[model samples]
Target: MKRLAGVGVGWRRQLAHTLDTMEGLGFVEVLAEHLDARGPLPEPLVRLRERGVPVVLHAVSLGLGSAEPPSPERLTWLARLAERLDAVCVSEHLAFVRAGGVESGHLLPLQRGEDALEVLAENVRAAEAALPVPLALENVASLFEWPQPSFSEARLLSGVLERTGAWVLLDVANLYANGLNLGTDTRAVLEAVPRERLAYVHVAGGVKHGGLYHDTHAHPVSTGALMLLEELVARLGPVPALLERDDAFPPPDVLVAELDAMRVALARGVARREAA
Candidate 1:
């Protein structure tokens, strides 16, 4: 198997310094905004591919698990875009961003209970049917709680993936951030989801404000987040691990150094797991 390491960043648009640095770092996936079925990729995305990096479509507006069906127009857009890139896969969150026919411009949480399964299943099927590669779903960062916490995040994710036979993109920092904010046990969160569905892992840094831990995707990989990732690696074993630094991108070389550190940590984890 390949080493399965990547320096991943969100968005294809660029600033002179940002694009130069990203190109230098040799990121594997440029999480593109427009994987719609019919439009041409922005010039920068074409450039990223020219450098031999693969692009994956991570849509902000694709809200598959929403109350209503995801827009056919958007799905068509994604299908066209996927064809354009020969992408590995397309990813969206386990989120309901639109409700009652209104776009919230954010990934809003559903009250994670029994009522959500049918809706999620329907959306997953729709999303999978339209894409060539398996549709991977990500766990979202939540700052609020429901009056009734129906199922753990893992169970919900596991259920949907199992039903749709889709892939999962596990975000460790999202789990850590939710754990800190909601006082949820991280191990229990880990235990509830199906480890087998984990196709890749994401690690990012966040902000601590007003006694709240927010998944802001700023800063460097924190000690606690890195520790949690180490734990995840031990349990789940090797997966395509990547860092998501959407904002305040350090110079390209600096981010690559951080990616190198992450690899060292992952190697240590794999060794410990194998030894035990």
Candidate 2:
């Protein structure tokens, strides 16, 4: 598969016009749940494809970490959408959003034990078989952790990749949030994953509420997250990285500036790699 490179942003309806005219965008990730496979494609997205900008379908409802297998219908929808758009790949969180007929409405962390890892692997393989393109699993941010985790975050992520042969959608912002809230060693997590398996990176903003850092995509990209992005890029080389903003839509210039900041981080990483 052709790997995504350079800097990009999450494609939302609010940013369609901005992205359509934005220069040097490598690709855009669309939330799969927000689109209907049976309906006509959004004009801006179609235009993006026409311009040779790759589109990656990011699914939120797959619940790949649930004990139950992934829903065939949802997998089918993702496959259909991917084929329709000629997407680069299909990405989803390594999280469970529902269980036992109850929806959590949020991406929840999984138990990083052997049994849970086995279940996650099974679900990922099932989804991979159903999809037309490659699958990339993302690490999510969480406010809490399951007690007595058998595996560290790095070990669990490495295990998933080793077993499923799926790509890693490294979310630097999520890593930062986890580090702040749960005391995760961000660099350790980055060093554990094989650089070759990394598909892309996600950088977003969050705010510190009370005593915890929330991975709220509604805020500005934190400096800590950008630093992590730089570190990852330095280790992995020029992989595709994106800026994500889900709410409190900022002005076009602000988004562009954020993208520019990402570019600067990426450049610094590249320069450091060269120096080393």
- Model 1: per-residue Cα lDDT over 184-214, one tens digit each: 6788666655566665677888889899988
Worst 10 residues of 2 by lDDT: 192-201
- Local distance difference test scores for all models: 0.71, 0.92
User: lDDT of model 2 at residue 40?
Assistant: 94
Estimate, for each residue in 1-276, the C-alpha lDDT of model 2 and write its tens digit: 668988888999999999999989989999998898989999999999999998899999999999999999899999999999899999999999999989999999999999999999999999999999999999999999999998799898989988997999999999999999999988889997687788899999999999999988999999999999889878878878989999998998999899999999999998999899
Model 1, position 56, has a per-residue lDDT of 66
Worst 10 residues of 1 by lDDT: 1-10
List pairs with backbone clashes in candidate 1. Answer: 36-77, 36-78, 37-77, 37-78, 37-80
Clashes of 2: 0
Off by over 4 Å in 2: none
